[model samples]
Target: MIHCARTDKGMVRTNNEDAFYLPEGEDKPLLFIVADGMGGHKSGEIASRMAVEEISSHINHSFLVRGSGNETMQIIKEAFYNANIKIYRTSLQREECSGMGTTATMALFKDGRVYIGHVGDSRAYILRDGCIRQLTRDHSLVWQLLEEGRLTLEEVRCHPMKNVITRALGVDENVDVDLVEHEYKKGDIFLLCSDGLTNMLEDKEIRDIILGAESVGAAADKLIEAANSCGGFDNITVEIILVD
Candidate 1:
């Protein structure tokens, strides 16, 4: 496996509120995560950083909880839930962080499959056979409208409410996490990113960049560069994981 990641504050954001976690070494069944935060002041950064730490810690300690992939899936869900509760509690304790919340998208690779636990709008994509397919559904107002057939894809892209996510971690005492599993294949590539990248670059453009790049690291750099070139209105983050 080969992986590379990059993040930038972008052209407009004063601070980068995006956080990601990628484990090192030859640890099979590794974990990868991307988080995008929203709140007042610098609370968004705090929320996203807390989420990454909490989730990564929980997953790392869950090694003793052994079971099949289905059982492992449950553990992954629990990690997200625990992370939510932790962040929510922190928000409650800090007046400045009171409505702080973040989007969490996590991918766990084990036993020839990738298990994803998601909330908010950060996304996961799988590239196989020279094509890219989105894996997670956005929990945003625009996505809801698109699903209801009330808006066209073009409208969703430019909608004023595009950033209005319906669900996020730390928003409440509890959160609903969506989980899915994908069968991994050799040569398959996974891209995990915050909405900053997605909002700035179209899926086709992203696909083209990744396909044309010489390495995963190059692809991550190019994605961030492209997002900044387009506007970079938010903090941009990208993670590229290539199966060997």
Candidate 2:
């Protein structure tokens, strides 16, 4: 079984605003996703919910992502693009949702490999042989500054504009996403999480937990707990997968 767990908190706000879920079924294979929404009004709920529902609907028996077909990167791009359009159009049709946007990170498991599609800062990580690697690049200004050598890693994390994302769904009609593919292995585990969790826990800390935990649920709980200990100033969301 590929274990998955999720939880969200309001943090300093009045509502538990963040949303995430695992696309469940015994169909082709397992696909999991996490979305973090941003909005000035109550549209945060609408944007994240729209993203999850659209992606889930698009993946159900519509595409044959198995065997040799599983390696096709173009299929992954189109599916994500459709989801972006679905949410963007929905936002355009409403007033409260006008300024809404969300960060999304999702993985599709088929055959013996996994394909990841991501936008904004929500991230995907693969853990194998007790090593953890970040699989998605953050589309944010701080990330751009880091890449340009204008800011150090330590400085970038705490920058005032660190939360400002450069790209997201529902903000524009066209979106640029990062597609990542990795072959599978026995005892491999994958984690999808929002920035709230990463903001408090360092990469090495995540590696240690994924390595030491007895099960995927335990590992996810430990990660969220670690973030809460540091401050929990924002909502935290996580999904863990163990491939066997």
Best candidate (score: lDDT): 1
Q: Total backbone clashes of model 2?
A: 0
Q: Provide the TM-score for each candidate, comma-separated.
A: 0.97, 0.93
lDDT of 2 by residue, 51-140 (tens): 877776666646564445443456656766887887788788887778888888888877677888899998899888778889999999
Deviation in angstroms for 212 in model 1? Answer: 0.1
Cand. 1 TM to true fold: 0.97
Instruction: Compose the digit string of candidate 1's lDDT tens values, residues 1-244.
Output: 7998899999998899999999855653488999998899899999999999988888887843346887888888889899899889989999999999999998988878789999999999999998999999999999999999999999999999999999999999988999999999899999999999999999999999999999999999999999999999999999999998
What residue pairs clash in candidate 1, if any at all?
Answer: none
Off by over 4 Å in 2: 65-72
Runs off by more than 4 Å, candidate 1: 64-66
RMSD of each: 1.2, 1.8
Worst 10 residues of 2 by lDDT: 65-74
Each prediction's Cα lDDT score? 0.92, 0.80
